[model samples]
Each structure stands twice: as C-alpha cells, then as structure tokens.
Target: MFMKTFGWSFAISAVALIVAFIYGGLEALILCAILGVLEVSLSFDNAVVNARILERMSAFWQKMFLTVGILIAVVGMRVAFPLLIVGVTANLNPVEAIRLAMEKGSIDDPGSYAYLLHEAHPQIAAFGGIFLLMLFLDFMFEERELRWLGLLERPLAFVGRLNGASLVIGLLVLVASATMVRPGKEIDVLISGILGLVTYFLVRGLGDLFDVDNDGDTDADDAGALAKSATRGVGKAVGKAAFMLFLYLEVIDASFSFDGVIGAFAITSDPIIIALGLGLIGAIFVRSLTVYLVREGTLDDYEYLDHGAHWAIGALALILLLTISVEINEIITGLIGVLFIGSAFISSIVRNKRVTAASLPSVDQLSS
Candidate 1:
C-alpha cells in the first residue's frame, strides 16, 4: 500500500521538480524542499483528520481520493488557486502575473510580493482562522454518527435542533463580525464563512444519507444492492460526500497554505517559486502524511490524537477570528496545535502502558 501510494506521489513530485527546474533553477529546487517540509509540519494534524475520514470510505472512493483528489490538492490549490488570487488582487494579466511570479527572488524583494501580501494579510487571517476554528469545533463537540461522512460529525446535532431563527442568528453573527472588523471587506469574509458553514452542513447531510448501519447483514448480494442503492441516493444528496470531502480538504489546505503563501512574499514574489516551490514541497508532504495516517490507523490506536488535533484546529480558528482585530503569527498558531496534540499523544501512551501493566499477571503470585 505504501509503495503504491508513494509511487504515485513520487511520480507527481518528479514532474513538479522537472517543471520547476525548466522554469526556474537550483533555487526553485531548494525552496521547494524547504516549503514542502514546512507545509508537512504545519499540516500533520490535517493528515490525521483526513486519514480518519478516508478509512470509512469505500475502496473505490479511496482510490479516487488518492488519484484525482491529489491532483486537485497539489495542482488546483497550490498552483492555480494562488495564481488566481494574485491575478485578481494585483490586477495583473495572467501572463504578466506568471512572469512577475517567475522573476527570481521577486517574492523576497521588498515592495514586491511581500508588500502585496501585507496588504492582504488581514483578509487571509480572518478567513483562514475562522475556517480552522470551525473544523476544530465540529470535531471536538460533534459525535461521529455518520459513517459515509467518516470523521465528520454533527455539530448542530450536538447543540440540538437548529431552527430557521438559529440559522439567522448565526448568519447575523458572521455578518456583524465581518462588518465590524473590515467593513469594506465584509462581503469577502461573509462569503468565506458561508462557504465553510455550507460545506460542513452538506458533508453532514450526505453522511446521514449514505451511512449504512453495521448491524445489517452485509452479505455479498446485500452489499452490492446496498451500494447500488447508495450510489443512486448519493446523487440526489445535493453535495457528494466525496466532493464535500474534497472541498473540506481544499478549505483546510487553503487555510494552512495562507501562512506559507504570505510568507513566500517575504521570500520572493516570483509566482513560480511560490507555486512550484510550495506546491511541490508542501503539497507532497501533506498528501504523504494523509496517506500515512490512513495506513497506520493512528486515530484508532491513539484515541486522543483526534481530540488534540480538533482542539488545536479550533484554537487556530479562534486565533484567526481574533486576527480581525489583532495579528497572530503562524508559528504561534502551529505551536498551539502541536502542544495540544503532543500532550494527548503522551497521555495516550501512559494510559496504554498502565492498562497493559494492570492486565499482566504477576509472575511471583502465579508461582506462589
């Protein structure tokens, strides 16, 4: 399994590297490696969460996620998305934007890429932070009742029934906050929030629609019929769970990519380096880490890991929300996640050891 996944990942990475080499040079290669490592470290929690979801998916879905999903992740978000952002924000023609990004060390030059990012920092923080926070809360407070949605649980369910009034109130809060913080940019923030909320609801609903109760007799014929029925039902379920999963993955990826993309402005504005370097390195590491978590069943063995990650995601989101008024460093945000998850990991090990010891028979007593 590792080899198969790794093989595909390696091939993709190789193609990315070749493209970077042809377009840029040795600098691109070095930067890509560094950015890759940074993205991996920051997104380890993401992998853990994604793995939990992947485990619940059917084999066919799993393959799609590995292949097509990866393409969307690495190419769509890291490459195309950033370029689109730059084009829109900078008002540069696509070719010019690409040229500007490819210019060596353009991101690092003062008053260049960094300047543009600095201007956009407030928006990035607001969007990325809130999205992360939502993810965290959904994981922590929500119970994992939907198998099709996998790790996704019902947050609103935890809170009990949400009437139209409640949805209105939630919308009001999002609107009020966005307006108060950045009145001019309220629309952007509101859109981002709505997207996140909608994605969450769709995933939850799809999970409910497709989830098969384990108690049912799952014989070959029964399973086949169930799958066929599910496929049809799934089509009716407005948002495909697989697609929602892809969207969720993209949202989180965008959130995590914010710091690096913004920071790349600090390095060099060259869009090529930003896209190729970060895309190759950060994107690959995240993908590999996700696969690793799926293969290892890390969440099953380390029950608290998910909790820690969710809490961390929640904290990160809160920090982002706070960014509307105050600036927070990405390093600090990342550290918060690490601390929570690390504590949980250590605690789990200790608990496991204690359980093991308690279960073990005392040799002296046995002999006596």
Candidate 2:
C-alpha cells in the first residue's frame, strides 16, 4: 500500500534530481534534495491536518487534490507566486521577474529577485501567520471528544462557549504582531494580517454555507465540526462544500509554505531548483503521506495525532509572528513541529496499550 501510494512521488523526485544535476551539476542536485527534505520536515504536521480533512472529501475531489491541486502548488505557489511577489514589490514585469529569478541576481542588491522577496517577507509572514493562527485558534477553541493537552485545551474550549472567541483572539494576536513590526511597516503588517483573517473567514464561511446535507441538515459550523459533519454527507460532499474544503486546504497549504519559499533563497536562488525540490518532490510526498494516513486509518488509530498537529501549527503561527521582529533558524522551526508530533505518536501508542490491557481479564478474574 505504501509503495502504491508513494511510487509516483519517488519517481518524480528522482526525475527532478536528475534534472537538477543536468541543469547545475552536483551542487544543484544536492540543494534540491536538501530543500525537498526541508519542505517535508516543515510540513509533516501539515500532512496530518490535511489527512483529517481529506478523509471527508469524495474520491473524485481526492484525485483533484492530487492532480489539479498539486498543479497549483507547483506552478502557482511554487513558481508564479514567488515571481508575482517579486514583480509587484520590485515593480518588474512578469518577464522581468522571470528573467531576474533565472539570472539568480545578487541577493544583496535591492532590485534583485531574492532581495525583493526578502523585503516582501513581512507581509507574507503576516498573512500566513494570521491564517495559521486562526486555524490553530479554532482547533483549540473547539469541543472535542479527545484532548491531547486537556489541562490547557479544556480551559480554552470552555471559553470557546463564548461567541466568536477565535475571531476575538485572532484580532488581538494580529494587533500585537502589527505593533511589534518595524515602525514603518506597521500598517503593512496590519493590512496583511486583516486580509489573512478575512481570507480564513471567507473560505470557512463558504464551507459552512454549503455544508447542508441532502436532508437539509447543516453541520459545518466551524473547522473542527467540518470533519465529522462533512463525512456525514459523503455522496453529496462533491459539490460546493467539498470544493470549499479543497480551497481551504489549498489556502492552508499555501500558508504553511510561505516561510519555506522565502527560506529556499538562502540555499539557492534558482527558482527551477526550488520548484523541483519544494513543489515536485516535497509537496508530492506530503500529499502521498496524507493519503497514506487516511487509507490506513492512522489518524483514528492515533487519536492525539490531530491534536499534536494543531499544536505544532499553533507553535508555527507564533513563530511566524515572532519572526517579524526576531530571526529564527529554519532548523529550529522544523524540529519544534517534529517534537510535537513525535510526542503525540508516543502518547497514542501508550494509550492504546493501556486500553488493551484494561479490556483484558485479570488473572484473578480469569481464575474466578
């Protein structure tokens, strides 16, 4: 099953590596491999989150995610989006942006592709940060049957009983983040953050609006509720609700990728290598992992996996906000996410063992 699921990712990765070798010899190939690994490491938690949502989508939409969705990831976000940002910020035409990126212009120069991208990082970070922050906040605020950090999550969930708690907290965090930005960039961060918040509400609102099942029952009030409520109407899930879920997933993926996209320049400014590494190889593997988890029922078997992923997301959101004023090592960011998910996996195993042990008859009971 694993092979069947990931065979294409491996094949694509191999081809990309070969292309990288041909394009820039051994150095490009190595950088591509490193960036690919980096993307996968940073996005492991993202895969868990995607699996939670993907399980509710129809088989056709699932295929669309792997096909059409990946096309957007590769061509749109990985390639054109970076160019667009560089172009808009640097006041270059599309052709100029493409040429600049291909030339691998001096990152130190203000007019360079890498330089412009770095300049735009504040806005990108703000947008991605708030989007992710809202996601994390919504997850924490929702009522759930299982809790990974009950002590903390329970209290938050209790407060979630209040109306629009996530929105309120998100705004506060956004304001706090905006205040900490460089004095001149405050408005930029504030506007970007508000756009992020609005984007989340729009997509989520669309999902909820179309969440009505065949019998006219609407259950997708929020992100947490969408999972269970969406699955309740699997056959009818292919319409707007499913499309909106797909859009939400794409937005989530894009937010998860902002840091990585900017960070890739630190390794190599060649957009081709970045695309080959992050998009073709990394993104594909992440999607395959999502499918593997869903088909294997891994999330259900490991109950806390979802919780851990959300916690990692929360940590990531905070880290992005922090990065506005403080520089953080990419390695540290990747490790933090791994730490959360790894601990959660261990906890789930221990819980399973305890449950099994309790269900079995004791020696005394057996004798009786």
Candidate 3:
C-alpha cells in the first residue's frame, strides 16, 4: 500500500532532483528533499481532516481528489497562491512577483523572497488561522458519538448548546488576536482575520445552499448546524454533493498550506524548488495518505482520531494568530499535531481491544 500510494511521489522526487540540479545545484536538491519531508511532517493533521471529509464524498470525487485536487494543491495553492499573496502585498503584478520569487532564493538575507513572505506572514497567518479556527471550532461543537478527549469535548459540546457559540468564539479569537498582536500589525491581522472569517461562512454557505436536502426538511435556522447536519442524499444527487464536498476539502487544504509554503522558505526559497519539492511531492503524499485512511476505514476503527486532529488544528490556529507577536518554530507546531493525533490513535487501539474483550464469550459459556 505504501508503494502504491506513493508511487507518484518517487517520480516527483526524481524530477525534483533533476530540476533542482538544473535550477540551482546539488545543494538545492538536498534542500528540496528536506522541504518535502518537512511539509509531510507539518501537515499530518491535514491528512486526518481530509480523510474525514473524503469519507463523505463519492468514489469519483475521491479519485478527483487524488488527481485534479492534487494538481490544484501542487500548482495552485502551494505554488501560485504564495506568489499571489507576495504579489498583492508587495504591490507587484503576478508575473513580476513570480519573477522575483524565482530569481531570488536567498534564505539568510532580509530582502529575499522568503523574508518578503515573512513581511506578509501575519496576513497569511490570519487568513489561514481564521479559516482553520472555524474548522476546529466546528469539529469541537459537532455532536457525534465519538469523543477523543471527553474532558474537553464534552464541555465544549455543552457550551455548544447555545446557538452561534462557535461563531462567537471565532469572533472573540479574531478580536483578541488583533488586540494582542503588535500595534503596527494589529489592523492588517484583523482585516485578514475578518476576511478569513467571511470566507469560511461563504464556503459553508455555498455547501449548504448547493447540497440540496431531499428529505423536505427546510429547518436550517442555524447555518453552523446546517454545515454538518445536512448530509448528502443518494444516487444521482451524490455527484453534486461530492462536487461541493470537493470544493469544501480544497478550501480546507488551502487553509492548511499557508504556513507550509512559508516554512519551506526556512529550508530554501527557490520558487521552482519550493513548488516541485514541497508542493508536488508533499501534496501527492498527502493525497495518498488521505486515500489510504479512507480505504482502510481507519476513522471508523479509530473513533477519536478526528477529535485529536481538531485539537491539533486549534493549536495551529492559535499559533498562526499569535505568530504576529511571537516567534514560533514550525517544528513546535508539527510536534503538537503529532502528539495529539498519535495519542488519540493509541487510545483508539486500546479502546478497540477493550471492546473486543468485553464482547467475547466466557469460559463457562464455551463449556455449555
């Protein structure tokens, strides 16, 4: 399964090696390889969340995620998206910005592409952070039988009794971050955060609007509720539902990738190297990871895994919002995610063993 899943990754890596050698040198190839591994490590939570979302989608859309969605991840979000942000923030045209990013690959200099991305970091962080906060918030508030961290999840669900509670929390985070961030960055962070909040609502709104409820239940008073409550209907409508889900997942992917692009700069800032190394190879691996999880029904077996991923996401969101005022290592963020999800996975295995033992017949019954 590993080889089958990551077959393209090998090819992409080989190509990245050649590309790096041609573009920069053997040094660049080494940096590209490290960036790819760093990306996979940093974004494992993304794979978990993606598996959850992908489970709801149709088989065709699942394939699309492996194919078309990956294309978007490598080409659109990870590569072009970073350039677009730099372009907009630097007041350069897209072409000019791409040129600047490709032409400048220095990591130590403050005037480099990576540094310029840092200049835009707060806004990038704000945008991704808010979108991710909404995702994390929704998961926390979602009513499900599975509970990974009951201590926190249960209380959160209790507070979730209030309508718009999650939305309120999201707004509060935005406001708090604005105040807490440095004065020079306060306005930019807030504006970007607000835009991120609006983008979340818009995506959820579109999903609810387009994912038609065939059951004739028109009671969608709470948009947040509708976001998860409205499960996809059957047969022909499945295609539409899956397509909407694809859009939803892509947005989620986009939210998960901002820090990745910037963090890759910490290794090297050659735009093509970043695009091919981190973007392509890492993206293919992630998609494969998502597919593997769903195919194996890992989520069904490990009930609390999604919960852990959400906790990690919540942590990442806070880090992004706080990055404006604090220096956070990408390694720390990745570790948080790894610890949360890894603990949950172990917990799930233990729980499964307990349940299996409880269901087994006693010696007395066997004798009878």
- The candidate maximizing lDDT is 2
In order, what is each prediction's RMSD in angstroms? 6.5, 4.0, 5.4
Candidate 2's TM-score reads 0.93
Global lDDT of model 1: 0.61
Note the Cα lDDT for every prediction shown: 0.61, 0.88, 0.80
What TM-score would each prediction reach against the true structure? Answer: 0.73, 0.93, 0.90
Best by TM-score: 2
The residue ranges of model 1 lying beyond 4 angstroms of the native Cα positions read: 1-26, 90-96, 103-118, 143-183, 212-251, 362-368
lDDT of 3: 0.80
> Candidate 1, which ten residues in sequence have the lowest lDDT sum?
231-240
- Model 3 residue 288 lDDT score: 82
**Model 1, 140-210: lDDT tens per residue?**
44445422223433444455344343345446656655865755777777776677566556655555554
Candidate 1, position 361, lDDT: 85
In angstroms, the error of model 2 at 17 is 0.2
Model 1 residue 322 lDDT score = 65
Tell how far residue 352 is off in model 1, in angstroms. Answer: 1.3
Native-to-model Cα distance after best TM-score fit, residue 206 in candidate 3, in Å: 1.7
Cα misplacement distance, residue 99 of candidate 2 (Å): 1.3
Compose the digit string of candidate 2's lDDT tens values, residues 261-331: 98888888889999999999999999999999978879889999999999999999999988887878888
Give one clash count per candidate, in the order shown. 12, 0, 0
